[model samples]
Each structure stands twice: as structure tokens, then as C-alpha cells.
Target: MTIRPLPDTLVNQIAAGEVVERPASVVKELVENALDAGGTRIDIDLEEGGVRLIRIRDNGGGMPGDELPLAVSRHATSKIASLDDLEGVATLGFRGEALPSIASVSRFSISSRRTDDDHGHVLEIDGGRVGDVVPTAHPEGTTVEVRDLFFNVPARRKFLRAERTELGHIEDWLRQLALARPDVELRVSHNGKVSRRWKGESDLLSGMRLHEALGEAFRDAALRVDHAAAGLRLHGWIAQPAYNRASTDQQYLFVNGRAVRDRSVAHAVRQAYADVLFHGRHPAYVLFLELDPRRVDVNVHPAKHEVRFRDVRLIHDFVYRTLHEALAGTRAGTPSGAGVMPADNGPAPSPASPGIGGMTSASGYMPQAPLGLQVAETRAGYAALYGGLPAQATHDASTVAGPPQALPDSGDATLPPLGYALAQLHGIYILAQTAEGLVVVDMHAAHERIGYEKLKCAHDGEGLRTQPLLVPSSLAVSEREADVAEREAATLAELGFEVTRSGPQSLALRSVPALLAHGDVEALLRDVLADLREHGESRRVAAARDELLATMACHGAVRANRRLTLPEMNALLREMEATERSGQCNHGRPTWARFSLPEIDRWFLRGR
Candidate 1:
């Protein structure tokens, strides 16, 4: 077979295969064009789920009569003119293929009139056949009407879902766009009945719109997050750990005002919520991450619902750290809301006054040097404050020594975030009263999170203590492995691994971190070398360190069924308030829950 150029109509039809998947796809393309035209108010009318007709009207800058024909021509776009313009495309719709592609598959008509013009020009196309441009009624904007989508291609039309299903897809996409652009008003009608309308909002993330989109539950349990650093800004509402969903429908993430579903961003979010949400439950959030346009590529997919960040790890860490810090105050409420999580390139927030839990640093539980393990100074300060005793003495006095005698003032505004513990229910739940109302806490889970944070601090604060192997374990390896061992000898030392190339294809491990948990040291070393060779960096050392700390915390934490005195319970509550990440246990289960007076009153049917 000889190769030949496909016809213009065929080319557009092929492009339509990508740009127009269903009626919803047509809705997306048209709305994007409206947004690019500087549309402020858009009204959409749908008939039979947009299959019979999709009429979109936008009050934006309209086009002249001469441009009406070009609007239906391929590769005719006003958004970009040069290669540099493509590099940082600020417009929502740049690809000129949308108009021509839709025209090739359906009966299409678009009309527009400039603000100064007395009349608008309209052009129609039926299955790639262009009609004469005619005068239309006056409107200082643009309106596009598409009828019988995929009518020329019966096979494609056959693939479309039911009417309601197609309309649902359109509604879902609109909601996502509304999240990023709260300034634009939107109106929708189905079968001539006005179905949905959202009044424009000036606030970046409007609580009213968010509640309308996500629900009042998500808004009630949301935390306002605003963090900006290193050319990246992440600000939005994140639902509390206790407020979650069975599915991931509520997680809406946008990069650079473009709604996108990225694995890197999603993974970062999942990791940030790792220890807070229950297993099988997904978090509800409407997070928006704003960064330089050049740093993200939004043209990766035809639908433009996914993006590729320039630096995956950098973006990932930014999103993860931002959300992680915002939710830290929920479990144990903040005192005056002073402490905040450190931004990507900044130091952690430190406490202004000395506290009961020895958490003097405002950065909460994060160590000054997580990688170097600098615990000696923290240990010394802790030792000196509570008398020169064992490090565990500063932990929980209730576990070893009996409960205290005299109680501190529990009345008025001086109570801790978790409030004063009134009693222990079933030796598991700690009942406390806060200014808000009643608070219930799981003793084991609360202690587990507290213990976990402290262990991580002490473990990271104290640099890894190297210990020589008693047997001096020897391992066989490849020639490349031997080279990596020699080249990364310093890196290994930094991670508490003292290894030297023993031969052309073997290595000798003589020392390891004393704090490192006992495991397959050889396997760990091999994995580290492999990671170093692949990514020029390794997470094995950090993962191993965290595993060890988690284990230690699990063992040291207060176990359930252990009786506690009133003073001990209150002391634990104070510690929780001062500690970061105390809202959820090590496993992401909520440690405490607030029950307002209204809820208690409702239960008792007060004033009924």
C-alpha cells in the first residue's frame, strides 16, 4: 500500500477521537474556550445529556465576522503564536483542534459579536460541510451550539453512555473547575429546567462553595492550610482524620489552577494522611498547589486532567510536608494556635515557653537534624529538667510510679487542648471536658502517637551510634556492587554503615548503627547500593531508621487496661496538646474526638 496524506475532514475526525470521547468531552472543550476568551459568566443548556444538543453561552470577548470561518478551521488559535508561548501557556485552551474536530462530527454553530458591534456573525457546519456565515441577534460574547454529537460516526455515538450518565460527567468536570476559579459564575440547565447555579466568589477557597460542592460535613471538619515556599504555594481545606469517605471522590487537587490528577501529588497526599486516616478510608480535601507554570507540563494528556511536575521528588515532598503540618493541631488543639509546621526550606516552629512534655522547640516533635540523629542535647535538657534520671523518667510517670496527689487548676481557660481528664472508661477511653464540650480519647492509641513522636525525636536528635559487628559479616557481590561500595563509602558512613570493598566482587560490613534495628544487614546494604545507583539517593537508611523508632514507640507506649489516676490522665492530655501529630495514632486512627454541648444536648433531647 502506498502512503498518502489523509483528507482534512479525516484528520479532524482522528483528532476528535482523542479530544471528543463523549458529550462531556465536548462540554470540556467548549468551556475551556470560553474561559480562554475571558468569560466571567457561562450558561450551559443540555438536551438529552448533550447528545441532541449542547448550547454554551459565555459573556466573554467575542470575535468579529471575518474570524467566524477561521474558528471552524484547524490549527487556527488566538491563544499562542510562538514556541516560547507554548512553553508557558497561561491560557486554558491553546490547542486549535477542538473547534474543527467537533464540527467534523456533528451539526455545529458558533455566534459572537464584539462589545462595539451591533450584530454577531454565526457559522454552521454539518459533518465537515461548512455553511455561509450569517448575521445573528446581538450579544456581547460568544455562544456555541453543537447538535447530535458523533452523528456522522454512528459507532462513536453508540459508545456514549445513558443521558443522565453523560450529564453527570459534565457536572463533575464543572465542579472541579469551579474549585480553582471561584470568581467565575456558572449556570446549567437540563431539558429547559434550571438545574444548578453557583454565584461567583471572590475568596480563593469559599467556604460556601466548598460546602455546596463537598458538603457541610467536610466544611465542618476542615482545616485551613496556607503554606508557600520555594516557588510553590499550597493552600486549601483538608478534612480532619475523623471526617473521611469510603472512596476518593472528595479529593480534588489542582496544580497551577488547572485541575489535574497526578500520581506524585496523590502519593504525597496519601503519605501525608498515612498515619491519620483509618485503613480503607480516603481523606476529603480541596487542595490547590500553585507554582510557576514552566515547572509543570499540562499538555501530557489530551483531556488535560494530568500533569508532569519538573521535579517529582521536590513537588512530592512539598505537598506532603504542607498537609502534614496543617493537620497536626487537630488531635491536640493548639494553644493560641502559635506553632506551625515548617515549610519546605524553613526551620520548624519552636514553642515559646517550657512545657510539661519537654517539647520546648516550637517545631513540635521534629528534630533539628533528622538525618544526622542529634539526640544528645535534647536528652541532656530533658534529663536536667526533671532531675538527672533515666531518659524514660521524662516519658510517662503514670506507667511506673503511682498517680500524683495534688491536682492542678482544671477550671476556666487554663485547661489543655484535650481538656482535663475526668475519668477512664473501660480503662481504655479517657473522658475529658474541654471548653468546647466533652472529649473522648483512646488511651492506648493516644499514648502510641505521643510515644511515637518522642521516639522519633530522640532517635533523630542523637546521631546514629556506630557499632562494630561481632562477626564482621561478609557478603558476595558483583563487580559493579563492589565499585558502588567503594564510591559510596562516605555516604554509607553517614548512614551508620562502615563498609569497604573486600575484593573485585565482594564487600565487608564491619560496623552499623547501634540504634538501627537488628535485621538482615547484608540485604539492607545491597538495597541501599542499588537505590544509590538508580536515583543518586537512597531512602533505605531513612526507612530503616523510622521502622526502628516505630517499634520502640510501640513497645514503650502506654498499653490498654492499665489504670491511671486523675492527675496522670490530665498530664497525658497536656502532653498531647504540646506534641505534634497527636491527633492520630501511629496507624492513623483518631486518638480523640470532640463532642460539642449541642450534640450532648441533642442526645438528651434538651429543651424538647
Candidate 2:
């Protein structure tokens, strides 16, 4: 082995491997440098996903003439002056390799001048070689022009995606940066035309405006979270329960004004949302965490995309608690147009009028709140509101009562026709005869599955059945649960649930789905409400619907342990044969597995 310095070209290419993974990476670095230099306005232009050209200009403090060349050299100065600075990184461009790495593999040119300077100088580097340092006229700031990215690396170029997809990546990165620095104006152009632009403005309203421009469904459901404790301040907007996407692309996270991904921060969010949302559904949030820079480490990666928190547990707990509180207060008010679940019946309470230290009735139906939210005063409030009431009053008046007065069959021709027939099982399962197979069915599972599908379709805007609450029942929940409920309101309404706040921490129960025949409305409400609290907003609706079906199926299905007559069994078998997808039950479990005569004989050891 020889220990010698590598060739300049080879070294540059190797560095490029880390700094330039895709067009988005280049944009991220350039834009970040602009921001670090105190740029309040930036413009980005791209062509063919940066394969042909990429240009970034920023109105920031620019480099002086003598410093132009060092800007493109590996491990150069600025950003970090000492090892101690590494311990508490605040800037986004500490690793000085980005410029050189990008320059080595592409045609790079930079024109920069200090804000006070009268004119800027242009410097060009082609394939890692300095071509010239000529004087040029330009506005105050810096502009870096990149052409033919990955030109010398054919293999890397081959990995580049289609132009549209590459552009999507670039757009996504720009949006993230825009979210982090809402105070900075950003303009992006691709293929010589303006594609995306954001005139950075402070405040949640401005952020929402940017979200609308991005067209990522960021505006559907948004929650404002602002809390401060023990030297850490958490502020940002979370998606309402009714607003959620099918992917993680909508989530924008920032820590101390720098956009970096920290698992601890994400986990805190997820944990806070646990039990309020459905599995596999993520909540959309643009959360900003502000704390002393000394409490975190940002020098973990060359790209500066991740960080390490000094007190991870504390951070997690703080975020979880803060969001949980904010959601609780917000959920107590009337749901917004975004389709948040209406508060249970009770006196309305807003974050501005948080009840002193008592868990509301809504809390009874939700997952346990964080210790911070379980204030003594809140507990007393919960006791005063619901403690002495009879069990039936606190639960549901409908349990002792019966179904809502069914109107005489309405002569409405618009209602679709439904065929109904039932064959009894060995006292448990039901066999329903249908055009398909005999439709041997698990009565409970089938009903539950049907209910879920129906609810989902309705929530998707295909159909809906709203059940109004006769008496609004107040529901008390942790802030996170409340948030989830708000996000999934439309979906819940589709399932025939009309939730509204009846009192502080109390949601009134006015109506329930007609299909959910005879069940404990109070219990069902508890389960549905709790699901929203655990999962994020996106999952909240699905969770509630699933729970409803689960309860329906449980009560409606045939009991497995019960015996049946021969006729009943035969009828059940016939119904099973007639059902669609009869092989599987609701919850995706197989309903039944058949054995042929030959298999039965084999089991008896009668095989010749």
C-alpha cells in the first residue's frame, strides 16, 4: 500500500460522491450557503434537473475578491474557526467541501461582492481548474452558476431520473428550505420559466400561504402549537385531524431555524399522537423547536441534514406534552372547515380559556394524557362534571333506551335497493344465501368489513351518512387526541357520527349511524375517540371507523362456541358459498379453510 496524496481530479470526484447525490443536494447546499450569508432573498434556476444547468443567486453578504478562489477549495476557511465551534454548530455551511466537490465534477462559476462593494468579480472553474478571475458588474450578493452536472461521471448521470421526477425532488427541497426560513424570499425557475416562488413572510398565516403555493394539501388541517418550558420553546403548526396525506412528503421539520431531521423530534411527534390516529397514517406538521444551541450537536453529517440532541428524552417529553396540551385546548372548540371531529357535547373551551387543572369528560374516552396535562385542577373539574352522574347518564342514554325512532319506510326511490336474507348457524355463525357462493359468513366480521368500506368510500367523497347527536356529550382528551379528531372530522361524519362540543371537555352525542343497531353509544364513542388520540390526525378517522366496525362485528357476528342444528349449519354453509371474498373476514383474517374428503380420509390414516 502506498500512502500518497491522491490526484486533484480523483480527489474532487470522490468528494463529489458525498456532496452531489442528486440535483436536490446541489440546490440544498447553495441555498443553505446563501441563507448562512444572511441572504433574505434568493433565486434558483434549473434545467433538465440540473443536468444541463443550475444557477443560484442570493442577496446576502458576499465574499471579497481574495476569498473567491478559497470558496471552491476543499477544507477551506470560514464557518468553523475552532474545534469548540464544532460542538455547537449554528450555520448550515460548516463543511467547506460543497463548492469544490460540485466544481470538480461540473462547470462552476461564481460572481460575488460584499454588499458595500461597488462591483462584483466573476470566478470560473472548469473541471476543478480555475479558468479566470475577471471583474464583472453585478448587484449586491453572490451568484453561483453550475453547468453540466456530473458530466465527467457517466455512471452517476445514468442514475439520474426522468426530468419531471428530478424536478419534483428539486421542488421538494426548495419547499423545505422555504418552510425553515419563512422570512427569506425564494424564487425557483426550471427550463427558463418560473416554476415556484415564495415571498418569505413570518407567522403561521404566511406559512400556510406558502403551503397553498406548494399544492401539497398542507392547508387542509393545521394546528398551531406554541409552548415554552425549561429553556426550550416549541412552536409550529400541526395538521388538523381531518387533513392528512398518503405520504411523508408533507412533513416539514426545523430545529432552531435550521432544517435538520432528528429522529428524536419525529418520535416525539409520533408518540404524542399514539392512539389518536390509525396505523400507517402519519400526521402532517411543520414543527419548529427553539432551544439553546449548546443543547444540540449539528456536526454529525457533511450535508448537515441530521443532528443529535443532548437531552433526547427531555426533548421528546417536552414536544409530546406541548402538542398534547395544544391539541386538547384546540379540540374543545368548534371544529374548523377542514373537517375536524366536532367536540363532544359540553360547554365549549378554547385554549385561551383552559379550565384550571381538570380532565374533561372527553379525557375519559381518550388514551392517558401526559403527566403534565393531568393537572390537579383538571382532575377536579372532571370529577365535578361527571363524577356523581348515574352510570347510564355518563355512558349513553341510548343503551337503556333503543334505536332512534325509525321513520315509517320513507317512499324515497333514490335509496338503493338492498337484498336481505339470513340463515342461522350452529347458534353462532350466519349463512346468508346470495347469488355468489352460499356466502358462509362470520356475521360480525362481515358487518364490520362492510361498515368500514362504506365509511371509507363516503369519506372519500363518494357517499356519506351523518348521524346527529340528540344530546351533545362532552369529551375530554389530551391535546394530541383533540388534534387528531379535528383532522379526521369529515371521515368521522361520513360514518354517521356528528360530533360537537357540548361543554368544556364534553362532546354532545346527538346522533349515531342507523346501521350500528344496538350497542353502548358511550363505549363506542370512547373507543372511536381514543383511536384519534393515539394516532396522528391522518389516522384518526380511519381508526374511529375501524373501531366502529369492530364493535359492530363483535355484536353482530355468530358465536363460534355455540352449537347449531343441521339445517342451520347447512344454511350457513350455503350462505358462505354465496358471499364475495368469503375466504377472508374483516380485519383481513381468513374466515374459513376447507378440507376435501381425501384430506379427511388421510387424517384418519386410511390412505392406501
Give the distance in Å from residue 34's predicted Cα in candidate 2 to where it truly belongs.
0.8
Worst ten in a row by lDDT for model 2: 366-375
TM-score for all models, in order of appearance: 0.82, 0.59
Q: Which segments of model 2 are wrong by more than 4 Å? A: 213-217, 330-333, 337-608
Best by TM-score: 1
Best by lDDT: 1
After superposition, the stretches of candidate 1 with alpha carbons farther than 4 Å from their true spots are 204-207, 334-411, 464-517, 520-544
How many clashing residue pairs, candidate 1?
A: 17
